[model samples]
Target: MLDKTSPSLPRGMRYENQLAMIEGMSLADIAREYPTPFYCYSQSAIEQKMQACLKAFEPTGAKVHFAVKANSNINLLRLMAKAGLGADIVSGGELTRACTAGIAPADVIFSGVAKTDNELEYAMHKGVGQYNVESIEELHRINTIAQRLGVVIDAVLRVNPEVDAGTHQHITTAKKGSKFGIAYSQLDSALQTAATLSSINVRGLAMHIGSQITSLEPYSQSIQRMLHWLEQLQAKGFAIDRIDLGGGLGVDYGNGEYLEYSDYAELIQASFANYQVDIQLELGRSLIAEAGILVSSVVSTKQSSPNNFVLLDAGMNDLLRPSLYQAHHPLLAASLSTSARPETFDVVGPICESTDCFHKNYPMLRPNTGDLMFFTVVGAYCSVLSSSYNSRTLIPELLVNGENVRVIRKAWTIDEQLKLEE
Candidate 1:
């Protein structure tokens, strides 16, 4: 049995979602069948967001390269691929899965700080679309690998503009001192070295200052830096063809800041109108953030002096962003979502680790035992970041398209977790 409250959904989301109500079924029914502590994604929402992104960015002739680090569920990947979105891969495993999902090798872009030689060889052999070259040493390594394989590798220099995107310190990756991209000073020499290498074709420039960035200032700074560097590269007699603007769009995860897809696209579209270079946007969070929800049940509620904790079945194992970055996700009693007198309570999960907490000292209306909780804006990093700590079985995943639903990834059993150990 469960209590009834309005679902804590995003601004335009439906409680009895069109996807949820199709064929007279609901999210709760799926949860009942699959049990608690699972992930449910809306395929319709994904398609809707993708369409929005495309419509918003086309003016600039930009191509969307969906970042695989978001939610790489194979079915979801296939859906995105079929939607004509290019892929941005970071690992050999991701590259392999991108192919398995039917993404064309030429439509995949590989980017990571520490790509192994074997991984690079595998990607190059598979003919990945572009390699986001991170460091000068990486450029040398790729050239060596390409030379050995009797092939030519196309690559873009990932330059660090050292712009500070006021996001979590862990996510602001474009700083001068960060390990992500080449420093400004070292970029030109890097291009020279690549141009001199017969096995490597220098195609473009790329940079992403940081993640969960809500403001436009940091992006503008990064873009301005890129444009200046781009001019410098062009002036030096280098033929750079593409501009890879890395992904860093933020979402309204109770951060009190919500960005519109149309506006973001319009801004970029305007910027691109002035530049004729081939452009790419490796979008991840912005495309999928509003498309899914995490459904967890309140098994127990505790009230101590000056503190309250709602013990949820979902933990950091289910959604690690909260514990990982001290991030917040919108939460409320799924049954009592419309209650006006919501109380503030710490939301914690069942993982044995004390860091498994979801929200601490957050205000919520008085929610009780057996009440379902809906964690909003979990569409991006939730399932993909899940872990099997404490030997917990992987949770089942349900994909919903309209009122239609399919159990994409099934919940784990204790036996399944121990099968390998035994």
Candidate 2:
């Protein structure tokens, strides 16, 4: 049973009978305008989620950086920038996008384990705010680049707290044996090394345990560890003025409950009060995941022995989370009569791979060919991970505000793909 009260359900979204409506516009009407196999994002819903996150972290004066990898749609980036949000980017292209989208360079934090020399040079030239250095080699690279550029580069040493975030193994970052951050045993040496570099300014430290994290325990533990490190660094006469608690806040994905913003804020405020340093949060999925969904139409239906299947035009190439992480997204009919019967279906996509399925034996109002379905909680990683595999045209993305709908990205044509080769 779907819980209507779940925080994962964005504002202005409701069910008029069996038809899903966003801000009073029926999904069928949206499909008629935009066609099937497209992504529709609710502008008001995105704003609501962003406001909730800001409100939760308000007491601490922490700046929230919308993680760019989640969904770096230029339009969405502009919306977030307009809301006074910063950007947490992992690549040079993302940095360009963030700046072009109106996020000031000072508001951008570059994070990733393997930042190349060219990327680091580009970031320094752009006057990027801070570099979350993952390894000693990277630290040296920053120092060398800054020396050549004749400017001091601000940076933070990313530490591995070894806290088991208890989330998906693929997303876990800080646990022992993970190749993400500076090892705890080598932090002192790294700080010593940083102090010796004339072009490097060790502003503070950063850490990201994992993504899709639903519990606050790991976050609290990681924060405590960071604070302890801050104290030690301060005692050692290192002027640490900032602490970036990396983002991994999770949203309910129909698999489990999420830690409410109030509770999460309380936990963060309690641990962060001991220090006077500026705080930064790198939030990705939680702020945007529930704000959008994939709307696809049923191409056909079939039965294989004891199981039934419903095929859609959207495939793993459209949204890779299910094929990559075995993730779950609640499926619902876009429109149905009150007399529609409920049946279990293995909803799948048009991809050729065997892992192209979205839902397996999930009960829903039985849909016929040409009927529409909504894959919930796909705002973050869906379109961002889409591809042109199997020679399929890239899907379009639409933004809805109140009853008005507009296209953010148009469907790429086969000719557009061919033009690249031409």
Candidate 3:
């Protein structure tokens, strides 16, 4: 039946009358309204995920912060704000976006390895809730900035537990030499250094192992290590009132199993049952990835020896995950014929580089020129990482709420791109 949903499709998506639909709106219909290579998100899907995450972590009294680095569209941020999620930003611009989207500064947690002075000053002026201090030098810098601003800034020491998250190496942050948090062995020294900083109040600890972590072992190990230190620090007379267990919850991107929110929350509650501190989680891809899809049109088809290439209008400049991290996203045809035979095709983009390919030897229903396609599970790191490479114009983004759709971001035209140049 046309109303039946497919198990292969992500949440908020289904195949209706052989056409892929998002929140009841067909991809083909939306493609006609907006140009191809645009991103479309389901407002309900995101809200539902947020609700599930909140429910899962509610037992631990965890404050969920949406990682601003993932899908930072103002409308999406506003939706996150409306859902009672705080912003975990890595830069000043994201802080501005969060605030502009109606998130209060007091709810923002500023986190990044190399926060510039200007960004720190701006965050301080805006009264960000906390800063995740990465290094002792950064701690001193924050102290100097706080002293200059005549304010005592609340901060958390991000400790590197040296746990392997088993995610992509490029995304892992907590390994021994990963240049993320301070090494676990150096925690005492970092705490000592923080003790000397008159203007910085080290109220808690933080650790972000990596992104897209599916296994529970890594989180278990890391949290155990952090809790051990938390106990030691308290024994040493430090008042740690919070624990920022940075987000690395993974989402299924055509890969196998991912960590369930309930399992994750149960782990957190079990680990911290005896502690009386505020727990914070900064979730990014987990909450948004499944809610979004990138729509593109097949530009042309090429036949080469042992390979059928489906060239698409969407390039790596639009969605870099495949090229950048060899990431895999489910590629589907917007409309498929009932009797269509599956074909193996190397899906590629029109970019000049050879790395512009999306998938190789991917089996899907045969696509023709002008056929609409979708790169599913791209809500998190896709559009935010897009660049105007090869002079390609930036694509637009649309938010779908049932039958209602609105353009959240307008396409960046060549004229607008040229205005920044001399």
Best by TM-score: 3
Model 1 lDDT per residue over 102-143, tens place: 999999999999999999999989999899999989999999
Stretches of candidate 1 exceeding 4 Å from the true structure: 1-8, 11-13, 16-24, 337-341
Ranking of all predicted structures according to lDDT, beginning with the best and ending with the worst: 3, 2, 1
Q: Show pairs that collide, candidate 3.
A: none
The per-prediction tally of clashing pairs is: 15, 0, 0
Q: lDDT for every model?
A: 0.81, 0.88, 0.92
- Report lDDT (Cα) of residue 132, candidate 2: 97
Q: What's the CA error at residue 415 for candidate 2, in Å?
A: 1.3
Task: Kindly report which residue stretches of model 3 are placed more than 4 angstroms away from their true locations once superposed.
Answer: 1-5
lDDT of 1: 0.81
Put down candidate 2 lDDT per residue, 1-422, tens digits, no spaces. Answer: 12366333455577777578887688889998787899899898889888888888899788999999999999999999999999999999999999999999999999999998899899989999999999888888899999999989899999999999989888999999799999988898899999999999999999999998888999989888998888998999999998988888888887666767778788878887767899888999988888888999999999897989999989999989998999998777777567867889898999999999998988877678999888888998899999989989899999989889989999988899999998
